[model samples]
Target chain A: MSRSQQLYEAMILDHNKKPRNFSVMDPHTHSSHGKNPLCGDDFYVYISCNDTEIEAISFIGQGCAISKSSGSMMTEMLKGLPIQEALELKESFLEMVSTDISPEKKKSLGKLKVFEGVKDFPARVKCAALVWRALEDALGAKSGETSTE
Target chain B: MLNPNIRKQFPVLKHIENGHELVYLDNTATTHKPLRVIERMTKFYTHQNATVHRGVYGLSQSATDYCEEARKKVQTFIKAKHEEEIIFVKGTTEAINLVAESFGRFHLKKGQEILITEMEHHANIVPWQQLCIKHGCTLQVAPIKDNGELNLEAWKAGINKNTGLVAFTHVSNALGTTNPVQEMCDFAKAAGVAVLIDGAQAMSHIEVDVQALNCDFYAFSAHKMHGPTGIGVLYGKHELLKIMPPYQTGGDMIDVVTFEKTTFAVPPARFEPGTPAIAEIIGLGETIDFLTEIGLNNIFHHEHTLLNYANIKLKEIKGLRIIGEAKEKNAIVSFVLDDIHPHDAGTILDTEGIAVRVGHHCAQPLMKRLEVPATIRASFSMYNTLEEVDKLVAGIKKIQGIML
Candidate 1:
C-alpha cells in the first residue's frame, strides 16, 4: 500500500465517514476540548463514568480523517471498559503513534494499530494524537482545553 | 516578462527526495534564498564580520559601511525619501510590535481607536489588540466583502473622529487579496489619521513605494523576499521616528550617557538597539540587487500568469471551490477540495513531494469571514513555473480520489 493509503486505511476511512459515538454525551461527567492550531483541527471528547467504569464515551468536532477516526476508535474501545484499562489503552495508543511498537504490543492495540503508520508522518502525528490527548486529560484529574502543538 | 532562467537561481527548485522532485508552493509563508544572497552572506561572515557603528577599527568601519549600504538599498527599494526612516527589526511581527508599543504609547490617548481590517494576519492583529489592552484604547475592525475584498465604504467610514491610527496588510498572506493601498492611504489622509501597512507579503510580490502610498509607517520581513531570515525593517517617516521613543535601550542606539541621565540618538538609531543581524542585513542588500535585476514588474507579470492559469485549471476540477476571489489579488490562490479536509490533502500532497500551506494561515479572523475552517494555499513567485502548478492540480485530484 502507498504511504497515504497506510495512514488512511479502509477501516480508518469507514470510521471517519461514519464515526461511532459521534455525539455529545448528555449529563456527561467529563468533557475536554482539543485543538491543533497549525492544522485547524478542533474536537471535544465527552465521557460518562459511573463508579470505576466508563459507561459511555463520545466525541464531536471537525478535523482530518486521522483525528476523527482515532477519536471514533477510541470511544469504541473505552466504552464499557474499566477506567484503568482505558487509561492503559490511551498510554499504549499514544506510544503506538509516536514510536515503533512490538508486534505483541501492536496486537494488543487491535483496530487502533492502524495508527502505527502515523510514526512515518511527523506532521500528522498531532492530528492522530489530538483526541487521545484530550481523552487523557478528560480521564484524569484535570479538564480543560488540550493543545497538541 | 520575467526571464524563465530565474528558476535556475533558486537551488531548492532542484531538490529531490523519495524519488520525487519537490514542488514548493508556499511563497507567501516565505521564499527560498537565491545563490547571490547566500554567497554574499557567506562572504560577509568569512571576511567582513565586525560590530557595526561602535567600532573605530578598520574592519568594523567596513562592516558598518556594508550594513548602512544595505539600509540605503532598503530605502531606495521602497522609495522612502530618507534612509533614517528605515528601522532594522527582527521580522514583520517585531516591526508591528515596535510601532504598537512605541508609537502607540507616544501618539495615542485613552479611548482613541485603532482601526484594522478583517483580513489582517495575526502578526498585524494581536499587537494592536495588546496595545488596546495596555493603554485603554479601543480596537475596531473594518469589514470585508463575501468575495474577500475589503469593503471600501465601511473602511472609509471606520476612520472617524475617534480613530487614532489604521493598520492593514498590503497583500494578504492568506487570501491573496491586495488592498487598494493608495486609495486607503488617501482616505486616512483625508481623515487626518496615521496608517501602518503590513508589507510582509507585498515586499516580494508587489512594487512598494511608501512615499507614493504616503503612509506614515510600513513594515516587512527580509526572508519573505529571498533575503536571509532573522532580519526585517520598519519604515517610519523620520519626523515620527524622531519624536517617538526608542523601542529597546542598549549600546548602538545611545547618543550620550551620564551617571544619572542618558540621551538617545536620532531617528533610525533611536528605534534600533543592541547588536543587529549583520550578515542577514548584508544578505538583504544582495536580495534587493537580485530582485531589482530581475525587475519587480516582470516578476509580477510572471506570477500573474501562473495565478490565472492555476485558477482556471483548478476550478475545472470537480468539487473544488476557490476562495478569496478578489479582483486585485496577486501571487496566491486558496481553495478547498470537495469535503476532504485541508490537513488530509496537505499530507497526501507532501507524499508527492509537493509543499503547500493548509490551515487558517495565521488569519483566523479572515477564515471566519470566508466561512472556511481552513484552506489549501498555493502561492507563486518568480521562480515557480506553470508546470509546477500543473503538479499541484494533479496532486489535488489524487487527494480527492484517495480521500473522497
Candidate 2:
C-alpha cells in the first residue's frame, strides 16, 4: 500500500459520503460549469462573494471521487478568505500539484499535498484539477481577473 | 483455428514489463496485431506499394488487386450478399458518420425519431444525435435494466412508424453486454425502421453474419480484430447502398465528369472518396483469415470461460463491486472498488505489468444512467488466459489492501 493510495482512499470516502459544501447556494455571485468530454467528468462551482471577501463557496455537480472531493476540499479552504487571497491560493494550488515543482515544496503545500500523488498517474491529474479549473473559471468570470499561474 | 502455437504469432505478447510477463487486457481498445497481418502490410509496402485505381502501370495493377481483394475478404468475412456492399472507411467512427450523412440525410425526416439504447458507445450515439439535430428529428434512447441489460420491451415501445432508424451496439464495450441484435433488427423491420449495428466490439469477440442479423448496416474496425488500425468496413445492403448518396465525393467514385454535370460510380467505390488505407486493408484480410482459422466458436467459448472465471474471482473481493453484471455478456468486467479511485487502480495494476482501461469509455449517457463517474474496465481477448485473470485478481486485491 503506497502512501498516495492511502490518501486517495481517504479522499474518495470523504467525497462519496459527506462531501464538503455539497449544496447549492441561495444567492451565488459567481458560478460556472466545466466538463471533460473525454472522461465524462462534469461539475459546477458556486461562489458567494461580497465586496472583497468570499462569503461562502459550494459545489453542486456530479463527477469522480477525485474531482468531487477536490471541490469539497477547495470549498472548505476558500470560505471566508478574501477574494484576492482565494485567487492566489488557486495559483499556489496549481503550482503545488504541477510536476514542474520540486517534491520538497509540494510536500510543504500541507492539506493541498493530497494531490501530489496524482502527478505520478497522469490520467487522474485532470480529475484532481477539474474543481480547481472550475473555480478558476468562476472567479475569473466574476472578478474580471486573470489567473497568473 | 490459428496455428496451435498462436502465442508466437503475436510479437507483442512476448514483451516483458517491469520484469513481469505482460498481461494485456485492453483488447477492447485495440488488439495486438498478429505476425501474418504485420507481414501482409510489410509486404504491400515493400513489393507493391503504389497509388491504387488510377495508374496504368504494373504497380498500380498490383496495388489495385490487393486493395480490391481486401475488400472481397471483408465482404466474405461479414457474409454480405455482394462484395459491393463492403465500403472501406477510416474505421467504425467514420463508418457511422458516413451512414449518418448519407443514409441519414436520405431516409430521416423532420419530426421523425432515431431509437438507440443507453448502452451505445458515443460513436454510435453522437452521429445519430448530429443527424437528428440536422434534420429536425428526435433522438430517443431505450434505457437499460438494473442488470445492465437493455429493456427489449422498452426498445420495442420506442420504435414506431415515426422512427426512422434504430442504431445500437452489438456488444457494450463498457458492460460487456451482448445485445440481442438480430431480434432487435427483426422488431425494427416489423416497425418499418432501418437498423445499424456498431460491431466495433462485437467483431473481435463473436462471429458476425450481417445477412443473418439482417441489419440494414453493420460497421466494425480492423484494429479491434487483430488487424492493423486506420481501416474498417461498412457493410450495407446492396439495395440500401444503391439508394444512399455518396458520403464524400472525389476521384475514383466518379463515372463521367463534364463541364455541365457529373455522374457517380456504384455502391462501395462511391462511398470511398480519397485513396484508402490500402496497406491496412490488406492486413485486415490476413486478420480475417487468422480468425476464420481459429473458428469463432472456439474463440467464443474460450472467452466465456475466462469471463466466468474473472467474475467469480472478482466477486470474492470484499469491497469490489463489479458493474454491468448482464446475463449475456462478452469478456469485459467493469468494476469500482469501495474507496479507491479507478485511476489509482489502473496505475497500481500497470505497475504489476497488467493493463486495463479506466474511465467512462466514451459512453457518457450510459455513465449518467448508471450513476458512476468512471469504472475500471478489464476487457479480454482470445489471447488472454486464466493465468492473466489471476494476475488481474491479485492486482485488484493489492489495490484494495493499499486503499483500505
* Number of the top DockQ candidate: 1
Q: Looking at candidate 1, what is the lDDT of residue A107?
A: 84
List, residue by residue over B146-244, the lDDT tens digit for candidate 1: 888999999998888999999999998888999999999998988999999999999967899999899999999999999999999999998888899
Here, model 1's chain A TM-score works out at 0.96
lDDT of 2: 0.84
Backbone clashes (count) for model 2: 2
> What's the CA RMSD for each of the models?
1.1, 3.4
- Say which docking band candidate 2 falls in: acceptable
Q: lDDT by residue for model 2 over B89-143, one digit each (tens)?
A: 9899999999999999887888999999999999999999999878899999998
Which sections of candidate 1 miss by over 4 Å? none
* Per-residue lDDT of model 1, residues A67-138, tens digit only: 999999999999999999888888888898989878888888888988889999998889999998999888
Q: List the residue pairs that clash in candidate 1.
A: none
All models: lDDT?
0.91, 0.84
Record all residue pairs in model 2 with backbone atoms less than 3 Å apart, i.e. clashing.
B1-B293, B1-B294
